[model samples]
Target: MKLYWSSRSPFVRKVMVFAHECGLAERIVCVRTVVAMTKPNVDLLPVNPTGKIPTLLLDDGSALYDSAVICEYLDSLHGGPRLFPESGPARWTALRRHALGNNLTDNLMLWRNETLRPQPQQSPEILAAFELKVRNAVAALEHEAAALAADPVSIGHVAIACALGYIDFRFAALDWRTGHDRIARWYETFARRPSMVLTAHVDQ
Candidate 1:
C-alpha cells in the first residue's frame, strides 16, 4: 500500500499512528505529499478529487480517503485489539469522544487558516466562531481528563492526542495548558508513547 503522507498533517499522523499500533507499518510505503486549502495539488486530483493527503492507495488499486475512513479500513486489517471499539457502550463512548476530538481538530485547522489570511481578507466573525468552538471543546475534554487515559487505547484517544498536538504546534500563544491541569498531565504521559514521539511535528 502507498500512503500520501505529510509530516505536518495531524490527520495523516493519525493514520500513521494507527498503522504503527497495528504492527503493519512496515508493509506500507510513505509518499510525502503536500496539499493546502486554497491551493490544490493538481497531480493528486486524478487519484483523489479532493486532493487531500493521507489518501491510501491499496494494492488492488482502490483508494481510501480522509483520516476517519482510512483509520477504520486499516483497523479492519489487524486482528489484534481494534482501534475502534466493537459494539457496546464502549463503542458509543469511544465514538463520542472521537467526534469531540475530531471536531475540535477541524475547528482548530479552520481557525489557523483564518489567521493566516492577509489581515484585510480574514473574517473576524469566522475566526471568533472557530476559536470559541476550540475553547469549549478543550474545556469539555479537560473536565473529563481523568477518564481519557483509563480505557485501553482507541481511535478516540488518537484523535484527542492529535488535536492537542496541533494546538501545541500552531497556537502556542493560546496556552491551552492553563487551568487544564488534568488534561495537561494526561497529555504529557500520552505524548511519551513511541508512536507520538516518532510522529512529533517539526516545523518545515
Candidate 2:
C-alpha cells in the first residue's frame, strides 16, 4: 500500500498512528505529498480528486480516502485486537470520541489556515469562534480524561491524541495544557507511544 502523506497533516498522522498500532506500518509506503488550502496538488487530483494527503493506494489499483475510512480498512487487515469496537456501547463511545477529536482537528486546521492569511485578510470573528470552540473541546476532553485512561485503547484515543498533538505542533501559543491537567497528563503518556514518537510532526 502507498499513502499520500505529509509530515505536517494531523489527519495523516492519525492514520499512520493507527497503522503502527495495528502492526501495519511496515506494509505502507509513505509518499510525501504536499497539499495546501490555496494550492491543490494537480498530480494528486488524478488519484484523489480532493487532493488530500493520507489517501491510500491499494495494491490492486484501488484507493481509499478519509482517515476514518482508511483506518477501518487497515483494522480489517490486522488480526489483533480491534481499535474500533465491534458492537454495543463500546462502539458508540469510541465513535463519539472519534467524532469529537476529528472535529477538533478540523477546526484547528481551519484556524491555522485563517492565521496564515495576510493579517488584513484574516477574519477576527472566525478566529475568535475557533478559539472558543477549541477551549470548549479541551474542557470536554479534560472531563473525560479518566474514562479515556481506563478504557482499552481505541481509534477514539488515537484521534484525540492527534488533535492534541496538532495543537502542540501549530498552536503552541495556545498553551492548552495550562488548566486541563487531567487530559494534559493523559496526553503526556499517550504521546510517548511508539506510534506517536515515530510520526512526530515536522514543519517542512
Candidate 3:
C-alpha cells in the first residue's frame, strides 16, 4: 500500500499513527504530495477526486481516503485491539467523541482560513461563528473527556488528541488551554505516546 502523504496534515498524521499503533507501518510506503484547497494539484485528481491528503492506494490500484476510514482499515489488519470498539454503548460513545472532535477540527480550520484572507475580503460573521463553535466544542470535550480519563486510548481519544494538536498548530493565539485544565492535562500525557512523539508536527 502507498499513502499519498503530507507532514503537515493532521488527518494524514492520524492515519499514520493508527498504522504504527497497529504494527502495519512497515507494510505501507509513504509518497509525499501537496494539495492546496485554494489551488489543488491537478495531478492528484485521479488519485482522489477531492484532492485530499492521506489517500491510500492499494496493491490493485484501488484508492481509499479520509482518515477515519483509513484508520479503521488499518485496525482490521490486526486482530482486535480495535481502536473502534465492537458492540455496546462504548461504540456509540467513541463514535460521538470522534464526530465531535472532527467538528472541532473543522471549525478550527475554518477559523484559520478566515484569518488568512485579506482584511477587506474576510467575513467577520463567519469567523465569529466558527470561533464560537470551536469554544463550545472544546468545552464539551473537556467535560466529557474528564469522565473518560481512566481509559484514554480509544478512537475518540485519538481524535481529541489530533484536534488539540491542530489548534496549537494553527490557532495558538486562541490559548484554549486556559480554563480547560483537565483536557490540557489529558493532552500532555497523550502527546507523550510513541505514536504522537514520532509524528510531531514540524512546519513545512
Candidate 4:
C-alpha cells in the first residue's frame, strides 16, 4: 500500500496515528505529497480528481481518498484494538466524537484560509462565526476528554488529537487553552505518544 500525504495535515496525521495504533504502520509506504486548496499538486490529479492529500493506493490498484475512510480501512485490517467499536452504543459514541473532531477541523481549516486572504478580502463576519464554532468545538472536546480517562485510543480520539495538534502548529496565538484546560491537558498527554512524535510537523 502507498499512502500519499502531507506531514502537517491534521487529517493525514489521523491516518498515520491510526496506522501505528493498529500496528499496521509498517505495511504501508508513506509518500510525501503537496496539496493546496487553491492550486493542488499536479502529481495528485492523475490519481484523484480532487487532488487531495492522504490518498491511499492499494496494491490491487484501487485508490481511496479522504483520511476518515483510509483510517477506517486500516482499522478493519488488524482488528487489534478495534478503533471503531463493533456494537451499538459504543460505536455511536465513537462516531459522534469522530464527527465532532472532523467538524472542528473543518472550521479550523476555514478559519485558516480566511486568515490567509488579504485583509481587505477577508470577511470579518465569517471569521467571527468560524471562531465561535472553534470555541464551541473546544468546549465539546473538553467535555469529551473528561470521559476518556481510560485513554481508549479510538478513531475519534486520534482525530481529536490531530485537530488539537493543528491548532498548536498554526494557531498557537489563538490560545485555545484558556478555559478549556481539561481538553488542553488531554492533548498535552496525547501529543506525547510515539506516533505523534514520529510524524509531528512538516514545513511547507
- Highest TM-score against the true fold, candidate: 2
- Cα shift from native, residue 184, model 3 (Å): 0.5
What order do you get sorting by lDDT, best first? 2, 1, 4, 3
* Pairs with steric clashes in candidate 2: none
Q: State TM-scores per candidate.
A: 0.97, 0.99, 0.95, 0.95
Overall lDDT per candidate, in order of appearance: 0.88, 0.97, 0.83, 0.86
Model 4 CA deviation exceeding 4 Å by range: none
TM-score for candidate 1, residues paired by index:
0.97
Residue-level lDDT of model 2, residues 79-104, one tens digit each, is 99999999999999999999999999
Per-residue accuracy of model 3 over 1-204 as CA lDDT, tens digit each: 999988887888888777877878889898888876688988789989999888999999999988888888887889758889886888888888888877788787778778888999999899889988898888887787576687636788878888899888888888999998989998898889888888777677
Top lDDT: which candidate number? 2
lDDT of 4 by residue, 123-172 (tens): 99999999899888888888877776465778888888888888888888
On a 0 to 1 TM-score scale, where does candidate 2 land against the true structure? 0.99
Q: Relative to the unseen true structure, what is the Cα RMSD of model 1? A: 1.0
Collision count for each candidate, in order: 0, 0, 0, 0
Output the lDDT of residue 65, model 2.
94
lDDT of 1: 0.88
Q: What is the alpha-carbon RMSD of candidate 2 to the true structure?
A: 0.5
